[model samples]
Target: MSGQQQINFEKPFIGSIDQGTSSTRFILFDSKGDTVLSHQIPLKQYHPNPGWVEHDGLEIINSVNECISQVLNKYKETNIGEISDIKAIGITNQRETTIVWDKNTGKPYHNAIVWSDTRTSSIVNRFNTKAESLLKKEQQSQSQQQIVPKDYLRDICGLPIANYFSAVKLRWLIENVPEIDQSNALAGTIDSWLVWNLTNKKTHITDVTNASRTMLMNLATLEWDSKLCDFFDVPNSLLPKICSSAEIYGHVESGPLAGVPIASVLGDQQSAMVGQMCFDKGQAKNTYGTGCFLLYNTGDDIVHSKHGLLTTVCYKLGKDSPVHYALEGSIAVAGAGVKWLIENLGFANNSKEIEALANSVQDTGGMYIVPAFSGLFAPHWRDDARGVMVGLTHHTNKAHIARAMLESTCFQTYEVLKSMEKDSNDKLVELRVDGGMTMNDLLLQIQADILGLPVVRPHNLETTCFGAAYAAGLTVGVWSSAMQFHIGKRFTPNPNIDHMKRINDWHKAVSKSVDWVDK
Candidate 1:
């Protein structure tokens, strides 16, 4: 369970650049999939307006470089492994976070619009109107009845027309940022940004997993659809070339790890699925980080969610390998909620102290907190929704609120799981989990009790990084196949706790949060 362990200096290692929403990390994994060394740097978030989130693209890339330098220095200090021992590097990044930069200068047009930002709500509304008119025209041509607007491209992209996707974000930037010229600008998610900089701007590419989340790539063809590009009014020239998750896209141009082949790239959640070894159909994993994401592997089949979930690319190991799809339910808030408690509400000094404070109370005193801060994501994609805490009384204290905040994450996760089962038509025997929040034993126990299923955590909670490492290692022959990873902890459902009533109460709180923002 310890990240520091005796190293086999003679073997090859895989380096993973895990660029996430709130931070960036560089981790080196040995042939056994164990963490050899790692370094992390916290990222700065900007909110000039409400419901808006942004990250400085320059700062992000700088932080990434700093992490690489720090980890490399630490690696050399060990005197265990030579720099050349790292045969390949991989990247897993926060998906849907759009960045537009000059193709020639490599300068971002503006701050990277975060995935959680809702500033593009107006753009979504405009697109919905246009889509409805198009649908009506098509129906009239076919001699069919006209209907309300629906997810017109969901069949193609496996995503709804929402502000959560990169297309919408890019549209927002194009409309607002007058200086950007579509022909001279390039747009992509975080993975593309890092890969471009890491290779000294020699490459501009994105893996299938990251491209799928952009709402531009066709789920069936795995390519950027011209029709979609036209619909969003985003130029295809602005996009990065899509590639497989595991391949040598380019090499590190300058660094201690320079000349290393950049072998693999995946969206963070999908990478966790790989790290969890959910290769078979129906296997699922939930990651609790800045947000919570649950992905259910559907093997080669793309199962569209009748319920409110997204069908996305799980992984495409190589150019010739068959594509794997997944049903994903994204929660906008999880660890971020805990963070809000510390930075905004002053609940505790840190997440650990908040857990301690919550344990002081037996329950939330009949309270419920619906963290619809950036609006609800899955099952309820309401951009108008806002955060709400109901069932408060004179007796409610900080302890009660802390418990409610923690319970909110568990409750949201349970809803997503139910939706996943409905879409897949198969029940998950156990839920595999990884992320920073999984370190909180109370939260995991509550997650199990709420779902009435066992929650499993791997000994290495850094599954996000490990997944990238696994794919990169596999590509370079550092590892021949998936290695066995042991489970660290398991929490079974509490037989005595009947959570139905509380779940129902939580639903009521969620309902109260919606429609707070007028159209």
Candidate 2:
């Protein structure tokens, strides 16, 4: 009772800018995984052609600004702050979406080549077959020449050479988009693109997680892999400087809220890993979204996969630190299958309706959908494996297709995580799950049953946003480190043994769907 005045409020608020594939979301979180104030805005997606997908870079930036502004406004209305008492900001963005801009005008040379874009499919196909083979052959032929392994799909940087990653897309831009080259286009992944814009073109930088996806950063050196860069026709000048995921890279020079420090950047998946507090070796998670991505943190050890899995960096905090790596297996389709039902098939009214339709069926009725609509990734990589459905009799209906589509997501994820465990020779007791689809109880339970492991779902399904916030919180001396970040709920594995039999039968159903696409 000695106090004449008292200031109340115990902890700090952390803001996260989650720049994702479909939209940009800004969420404010307290120490616990509680959403204090949040706002999300969907951006316009551009389809310039049948196979090409793009998002306006300026719009992406504007949307990000708006998302952050919305959350800040809500905070003010809620008595959180008219003046920011925010500790830090974390940025987790869609990896591999390539955006090139003119440094002078600070305008994107063209619409960003979203990670979903397939403009480089033919290029990737040709590289996979010919140039990659020749490089391996040459390496093997030379006796003292660090002989490359047979059938080795050479690891470019710490990443696989694919149309999904950015290096190939950057090459495509240089070769095809004349305007980009004429501008001496400065190119980067989505995170870097945002960083450049955020810092007012002062920081052309990206973190280890995002850079690792570019097919240009060496897993060991933690620098841009020059050999791979040259191979991809990506000039060193076009690349951003590599930086730690958690560090004060630059300050906000101009924006709605000026003078705030811009700290911490991670690829969306790796950021989710941070958000989930997956700080140990063998800890793994699968994000169920437009695509399902399974990443297993291998820790300091770089275990090259004997299986189809690709070796990639999980995240790195400092330059000299042991580079924690991961084995990633990606499915080209997940929520997109549900999305297709909305836009293409008219099978479901919205995302939730797809779940209802799927539940209508007791099972898929031996119908399997391999959503290779884009291409098969990891354990498959058959770009030629176009989407197909099998066991489609007159009896099959939208319910069956819906069930099969949702099943495909779990099945694909099962195959990937299965391969990761196999490749690492580690037992996967449980898998941490996130993303929009992970909200579905049926999907979560089936995911557990199909994998025969606990599928842990966090309370705040937006792990992606929290991850970035965690990083930002760390960088500004708000949070100590990644290990200190608090986590929410965990979904334990509890698949009934009876469901195991059903899962095995489901696999057989999947067999009928594979290789159905014409080469």
**Positional deviation of residue 143's Cα in model 2 after best superposition, in angstroms:** 5.0
Pairs clashing within candidate 2: 90-468, 454-493, 456-491, 457-491
The alpha-carbon RMSD values of the candidates against the true structure, listed in the order shown, are 1.6, 4.3
Which number leads on TM-score? 1
Worst 10 residues of 2 by lDDT: 1-10
Relative to the true structure, how large is the alpha-carbon lDDT of every model? 0.91, 0.77
How do the predictions measure up, each by TM-score? Answer: 0.97, 0.91
- Model 1 gets an lDDT of 0.91
Steric clash count of candidate 2: 4
Candidate 1 global Cα RMSD = 1.6
- For model 1, which pairs clash? none
In model 2, the Cα lDDT at residue 32 comes to 51
Per-residue error at 239 for model 2, in Å? 0.5
